[model samples]
Target: MNDYENMSDEQLVQLSLEDQDCFYYLMKRYDIKILRYIKRLTTISQEEAEDIIQEVFIKVYRNLNGFNRKLKFSSWIYRIAHNEIINQYRKTKLRLAMIPSNIEDQANLIDSINDTIEINGAYENLEKDERVRKALAELPDKYREILVLRYLEDKSYDEISDILRKPPGTVATQINRAKTSFKKIAGRHQLNTGIVK
Candidate 1:
């Protein structure tokens, strides 16, 4: 074990400044978690998600000196990842809108998956997963952001508020509302698919 938890964030910052390898250690610790979080937020292709991950890390490396020790390192990195994904989404949406609809098929899209195994002779969960992802993608960005941050990223309301620069009470209400909205959307999708009676 690297005992990274034992080292203070300030110490890590100092070490990262002096040694590039030390910075790589921080990236190794958080990259996968951040990538997974980003994957749920946007429907970008896997290759594009990989590129965004690299870009987020590069931005983190360049801005490491400005990081404050008061905030947890994970919070700081996730904020960066969130910003990068949103930026990429805007760019992609603009680009796609400019292209002819028929030619948009050239874009490499990654199919999102949602899978869970059950032991009670239940129907395969793949259908449920697909419905959820479709419903989630249809939500407004504000609702989707709160949902992913709360459910998928497993971030506390305070952490999410800090990351999003929102009030804690607002975050809580947004999450509550988002859950209802998501359930409605998922229900509608299930009905449309003949998966629910």
Candidate 2:
């Protein structure tokens, strides 16, 4: 409904706190995006991902009154979701990013990774780019997260810092380190994947 859609996320937050029904609009706008982010960040199955998303939205609603006006709503919600993901990982040692978000350019980069794979033999299936998946999976958690936020979400350094609750300078350092680590992993595997830089 235009009435709901026309309102900014901050305005809707105020409305939702007063009337729970108003929250659905907020859910509708972010559910899928956050869902995809969940999957990309974790190896959770579709069902589990949905459960996490439900938890995320519930947290958002419960914390509605605490939402900060100085920050973007999207950033705030993402920070909550990221914390949830970290908590899930801590509790269950759940999976982290293994697949890129299916960006054509990223897919191309994944394919290039195949050439760099020092594995004994080529993966029979590249459809899911399993080799590429493994490479991403091998990355340290901090590195994997930075790459996903930067590339898949197309987020800026400040945005990523906000989501990760780190200083902007730290985020920048991690991103650089992530790229270097990614390259090192490729080197260890003897894959000649082109420069990720």
Candidate 3:
């Protein structure tokens, strides 16, 4: 049994190219994260989302040699998933679903955003915060996606930049803008949330 868990993504990529069995480990590493990301972006049934995931994996396998070693493998994979979602929306006219599915993910996202925006006790009563949820779903795709990448996914600025194919400066600016937009929306919705600056 190979210590696939101990191997770096780059190492796994190389091994996967030579032995297709190694690719299974790579897919296992990313399946759930990518699925959640897809769900975050669109309101699709589980079967539909699984189909999209299969397509992403197939594309990743085909483009394995094109992977840029300079980028973290996770970032590269996410970029692929992002493009695939956009393509699916274009092809099928799927409605983008910015609201997270479950309360746990919603609370986690709120907690993470609080790390930057200083929301007071938002996570504690997240289940009751329909206004906050509405505010999030109302955000433009660019802002919502940026927030999901930065807060929910816990991606660093550089990682987000690579994943979104944007410059690092732009990534930082967008995150700031997203926080501001969320604050404004929260205010308009009369959310019982407290934001410190």
Better of 1 and 2 by lDDT: 2
Cα shift from native, residue 139, model 2 (Å): 1.0
Which lDDT value does model 3 have at 2?
63
RMSD values for the candidates in order, in angstroms, are: 7.6, 4.6, 2.5
- Candidate 1's clash total is 0
lDDT of each: 0.64, 0.77, 0.85
Clashes of each: 0, 2, 0
lDDT of 3 at 19: 100
Instruction: Give one digit per residue, the lDDT tens place, for model 2 in 53-164.
Output: 9999999999998898988899999999999988888988887756554466356445444443333434355533554566666888788778778777778999998899
- In candidate 1, what are the lDDT values of residues 1-197, reduced to their tens digit? 26755676567778889988787667777878887766666555668779999999999999998887778788888889888877887776612111112112111110111211111223346655445556655667787667557655668988998788789999988876765665567567752322110
TM-score of each: 0.70, 0.81, 0.90
Between prediction 2 and prediction 3, which has the larger TM-score?
3
After the best TM-score superposition of candidate 3, give how far the Cα of residue 68 lies from its true spot, in angstroms: 0.7
